[model samples]
Target: MDMGRYLFRQVRGSDAAAIYELAVANEYHSDNLPLNRSLIKAYVQRSVKDFAIISSSGVCKNPLYMFVLEDTYTRTVVGVSQIKNILWRLLYQLRLDPFLGENIGKLALKKEDGTWELGGLLLSKEVRGGKLGKLLSYGRLAYLMSKGLAPRMLISGFLKNTFWEYIAIRIGVSKEYNPDKHWRSFKTLTKFMGLLPAHILLAETGIAFGYFEDLFKIPIPIKPESEPARKLLVDMGLCFLKEIEANGILWHGAPWKVIRDDNFMRYKVPQDTIEVDTCKTSCHLDIGMAVLPSDDFRAQYIPVAKLEDGRVYISKKDFSCGKPKHLFIFETKNV
Candidate 1:
């Protein structure tokens, strides 16, 4: 899927400066990100190193990719998403198997097996409410699936939100949750409040309240209202399990979602049916972006070329530019 106006590419060392600008913009919404210029530079460097050779092999194995979306016309870096092929070591150390056994039903995410984490997705507001998001999501899967590198399972953590709640209802995740399980299992309050003195906490509630009044104000285990999680569920067969994981947080208190890889084959759009010369139907649309009548053909990415047969398409060759070499495209609207 080509993002009509924007092209997605792996981050290069040179992209650090531009990505930093984008990162800082997201920093304004503290929940979105908190990267300073230096961390942003290191992030780009890590991404470049992680995917340097394997990404182009049509499969990225034992991989990680930090993708940057560039405005084809403006040439500015506008959006980004990150994917990692393996779950990090920290999850095991956190000791959350009981949570998974109790809340996640039959599925389990293991450290040794191939599991991929999809996150670090940020799209500029201009591209937020449309197909751009889906292209980035499905395109990665398309790439992974094609290379036979698709994980045995998929996992992601998100800030709890109305969209997550909606996904829960739509996918049969129960809402009969204690909700306090988040705070009890995670110990979020004690960890964050560790900044304050022990004596202040050991004192009477009255004294503790007086000494650290502000800390008590914020609610723990923030419920997230994510529209994006719904799109992920559709494209990747993911569901919001009640279990919250510490691998990543949407803000400070996001929950995790998981599903088996077999679900991808079960749920994927049958791309083999669509006949568009320049497009593959496997590229899914955003949640609710689908038109009612199946015959309707709305353009997601207007191809750079319409063949003599009137087939509209943008091929992998077209996405190559100086800054963006190997690519995927995602845009809010026709450019």
Candidate 2:
């Protein structure tokens, strides 16, 4: 169980086949997206490009990084964890429209005021016994902290289950179940119905239960056995933010003093590092607080700053003046 034998590194194009095979084998549990060779290839390519940009620009704000746990003996990837720049993309593409599209961005903007989300933690079935999950989870957070992007608050969503909730409670991140909670009642009703045979439930409600079931199939069952992992997360300081039916999301925050502590400062900023690439040309000034430059654009890491006029400025080294392009300012924070 020497975890050090498995190192984390940016995934490469050559890894497409291995990743695709892994995804295909685990599709029944992990991803519902259609399994196709072409699509998988495209995903790998996009991920590679994204890692390149983040590595080159020294930007840690984007959740586009895919760190793989490699088996040194076999030279294979055994586990993967992901952080996202934006969490609502999958929800949006599905057209499920949980909340209005505009509101989604607004909510993210609001959340960014003090928090960031940590999600998409998955590991191969073979690698489940050790403390690899914990290591990977903390590793991602550590990476974020190094970029000066650690958010005060960190959040994660979990499907409803006693095991997971118990874990959250143990970590002091979740509250004891309260019958008065609105979401609790909703979840109880949903689970009750979910227990019935699918056809029976569909017949009773006259709702296309299969469609919804297929669409939102729970990859992992909410069993009591998974409480250990849940407890571990809560202990690390995450709490329940909101719950939808049988699902709930949690939040955690690092104390202000802890964030400014000397140990944290040294852990976050690196002294020796590669120089960041700068813009090749001058850019036009825009009437915006910050610009949401495309991930394709080449730019240096810019610290976010507040202006005297009550506007925020994402300090960029150069304003690309070539095209009369408009850039939307995206909220910046580390997850």
Candidate 3:
């Protein structure tokens, strides 16, 4: 298929059915999540609201973009790539604690610095072949850069499997943090106390009480079939940052610039082309801002921009609070 005519556009309300079908297909293929049409509808609605928030804030001077690869010939949508400014919120909502909480703590401690994240890249099975995956992946990077959010790193979490591990190794970046290993020592206590209320236990122990067992990875025989995908990620310059077996998964980090240079911007958003649209979707919203407990909590706010000259800006500020700043996390397994 000639991909030239297939432009990537922001998903519209009319795309609910297509998006729902895609979610169903993915869930069926991966055994990842149960397919519920109402849930998928909610997800699409949330995406629309997030876009509106970005536009109204004028934070990046562009709406937080979610692109759906459209077959101009058939007018069918094929894939999706989205850039979320506050992706940690998504991780938190999913109750993907420890993994997201650890990172949020790191971010709080480093409040003087600036960082952005790219997330949620899902492509249809038919389009997973060839350079299209790479195109959609990097295509998102290009779009973010244009929005003035040139993120230093692109973070992703992959399931613990030989195929994925092998891919990280090939990419020349591999680290192991077994969530299971970390949780083994605490399992007995957790199991014994599992019946007690979490708040009561925390009060008694002076330590937060939460079961971390479900996050650990179970060792399974690797099928002979799963190595190629791992190889591809390694070849693309992604590396394993750490292994959190206690959480049943591994955390990987990839540098965005390594995939493509600044020049890749031309392929996604053209210069001097400002397109705007209205999004009137209803969804839940939560905002979290926190200051670190460390000294010198002076917040550093920097502007994000697409132009080399820095035409767009996002401001960050520090605020005083009774407890540590609240961190928002978002996660959805019920697709």
Candidate 4:
């Protein structure tokens, strides 16, 4: 999607310095994406290698991508988003639902194949509005589609709040500010917690003290500030699964096709690509994005020539890698 003065693309090696500057200047720094220069460089290097491997072989063991939203004219990196593949065992759990009664369901990992996590999504305070957040968040998905590597499930986790802080202390694992370590402990706690069979008798007492163990992955309360993020995911076709996989974090997931279809209803894509000699027509406000095919994975919001014969046309010069075949053109909206 076009932000007019901004451009979004995968992280390049030269972006490490700017990324570090952006991270340090931001008031709220995420542990998953630290404010260290060396770390930022490592992330950029890894993303470049990962992109190359995926482009050539069409698969990778560590399928990770780091994307940046840059100020086009200024050439400054103002925002960043990361995508990585992760695996979790599809375990079962018993939940005591107030209205639904006791129900046994698979822990909310969503799919047996694996899951793709959207994390480390951060934007500068100055550029927070006008659907830029949605651009950074959903651009990761667009990148996945460009590579034809959409996972079976997609997820994002929030930070732990005070309510969870108290519960964590009682559970013997104090709230760790680091999200990575906190999530690791949460996973370990769920394993043996399921063995205890006294949930029914100890339910009320557990609630009174705020240390109720469900003998499974405990559901963490969604913090107030994270509500908007959660709502966006829900709007994108994800549901709040009962199984909380991390501390103070609410996890949401659904089949990839569900999200793809939901987004399709909003961001309609052109069925085919039309290469033209020159982009001689006015800009199409409704058309917002053009994505190259798998061999040359790139997405940008460039001017498109007016529709002719019911086909969307773009100039050959729109892409730097020469003429692309079957590029996906997405319609633009507030979403």
Candidate 5:
């Protein structure tokens, strides 16, 4: 068996090829996502350049990011999620023709209070609902915490007619809002977008392709449905936000929900492996970082430490922003 280990890192331009494959898989099931080979390639290049500049120079930061789940042994990109330091809302004037004037939406993140949003949680068949999801999701939070950009609330939207959206509606954290006044057009667009080849669709848009892609990011409205999951969020103290939602043709129908829990950070950080003794020349943690137990009892990100005299040693504290820095990868057979 080829040994493999999982890792979370800032995406680079070189990852475009691998990530394109992953995006294809995601677009296969979720038709509303406006990701194509050309767009993803562009996304990779743009994001890599931006992250490098941000990571090193801290200038002209876009605050728009995509994090990938990698299998180091195979050198494959398995999954991806997007993060934004701001949320842009579409603002359009209801004109003589609603569709014609739909061009007035903020294509930038919200700058007030510096609220960050987490979206685009796409995982591979091998990792969805598994430990990798937790690691990837929490990893974003960890990175944000390190940069002191952690938001008091993390916001996201679920697509219509999905199990995840079903649960979200039930939890009462979000409600569905639809814009375009004529939701019929909106429905037709989503329904038909997935029916055709992605490349053809992109070509059809011509110079307007980028703008179309941004519109796809907006969450469509979903009807409120009751479910047991709603009670759990209520118990956890999560509340729905009536004000400050994405306003425009972009997210007219999706109910924007917010979660507030100071205690939620505990679950996003790897408390078990984030600490290491810096006093010794070298020290060994029982397991290297991110070597957590998966949902099916399989080990994800299993770390391999060289054992001399059956001991592990390391020097320097493994922490950033007062929290444990996450593990990248280690050789292992687990996948």
Candidate 6:
């Protein structure tokens, strides 16, 4: 989809080079977006295949969609957004009462239908402002709801390194935290524990666990880079699920129905042309993303739209090529 000087489309194999460059440039802050060339290429290939399969059969064993935003002026990719099946894992959160040192409870991972994760949003520093980031982020949901691929539940992870920071403090070292430090400490701690008898070790489990009891007490510093993404997730209706925390980062989750209702997920095809209002005047016009339902999906910003008879009316110029089967319509805030 064309957004003036920018374009949004599904990732193609040809975009591997541009995406690799984008990843390398943002390596310092890269979350899910990898910096490896081969890994990025494989992701592009899988994304292309997954999109094709889902468009055709409406099913894929491992679904993953990677969307790219390109600068039309330079014909180079500038931003990326990703959607993938949620990775389910079984793990326990070791907690101890700060005062009494008692175990709270262990949690087992559960699976649910229609669950997906929205993350891996990265943009070039040059195109960091404006609504470009929102377009790349929300446009993925627009496409999913348009194609009936919307997840029943959506999850998002923020503050990538905050988990490691928590671990650093638990190890009694903050600034000097690394793999070497962790490995050395792990060896020393295990060897010391090995010397204790089974009964003694079992009895001291509470004391051993108490070392990390300060997990929740410490204030986590939110990274400046992840603040915007977190805000977008909150705006999308996701809330913190206190039960889950991976790598020190708390995951946010919400039902798809909640997001759908909050975003006004009513969709329709434009029967006739309507004037595209830029909302520059005092008059108010709702902004949303218009997605073309086709094998080659394309989505762009729609500044003004009229919802009537459960059908959306948009500017004829937006669909100059031909009439589309469906247009994904959603209400957006602050553009």
TM-score of each: 0.53, 0.46, 0.46, 0.68, 0.50, 0.71
- The lowest-lDDT stretch of 10 consecutive residues in candidate 1 is 200-209
Best by TM-score: 6
**Between 3 and 6, whose TM-score is larger?**
6
Cα lDDT tens digits, model 3, 24-64, are 67643221111456654565666676555554555542234
Kindly list the per-residue Cα lDDT of model 5 for residues 154-201, writing each as its tens digit.
544333334223323443433342232222354433433223222110
Task: List candidate 1 segments past 4 Å from native.
Answer: 1-3, 28-34, 55-62, 89-112, 160-225, 247-300, 303-335
lDDT of 5 at 288: 36
Query: What does candidate 1's lDDT look like per residue over 1-335, in tens digits?
Result: 33566655556788878776776666422222335667667766766775655545544456766777778788887777766765432221122246443212121233545666676676776566655766555545544543445466566656433322332343344343222332234354233222222211111121011111122332233323244445455445554333333322321111122332444344333323222233343342322111111111111243332224532243343322211211223222222
How many clashes (backbone N, Cα, C below 3 Å) per candidate?
9, 15, 34, 1, 19, 1
Query: Looking at candidate 4, what is the lDDT of residue 237?
Result: 86
Misplaced by over 4 Å in model 4 are: 36-38, 89-94, 97-112, 161-163, 166-225, 271-287, 292-296, 302-335
Between candidates 1 and 5, the one scoring higher on TM-score is: 1
TM-score of structure candidate 4: 0.68
- List lDDT for all candidates, in order: 0.43, 0.41, 0.39, 0.61, 0.42, 0.61
lDDT of 1 at 247: 25
TM-score of 6: 0.71
Q: When superposed on Cα atoms, how far off is each prediction in RMSD?
A: 13.3, 17.5, 18.7, 6.8, 14.3, 7.8
> Candidate 4 residues 94-120, lDDT tens each?
376687565433334433456877888
Between prediction 2 and prediction 4, the one with superior lDDT is: 4
Q: Give the per-residue Cα lDDT of candidate 3 at 22.
A: 76
Which consecutive 10 residues in model 2 have the weakest lDDT in total?
200-209
Q: Give one digit per residue, the lDDT tens place, for model 2 in 1-335.
A: 54435545456788767766666666422221124667656756776776676657654454455556667679987765555454231111122235543111111112144444555455667777765665555555545543445555555544333433443344454544432242325444343323322220011111111111222332323334235556655555544332222322323334323533532333222212212234332222212221113433211112333233433332224333321122222222321
Higher-ranked by TM-score: 1 or 6: 6
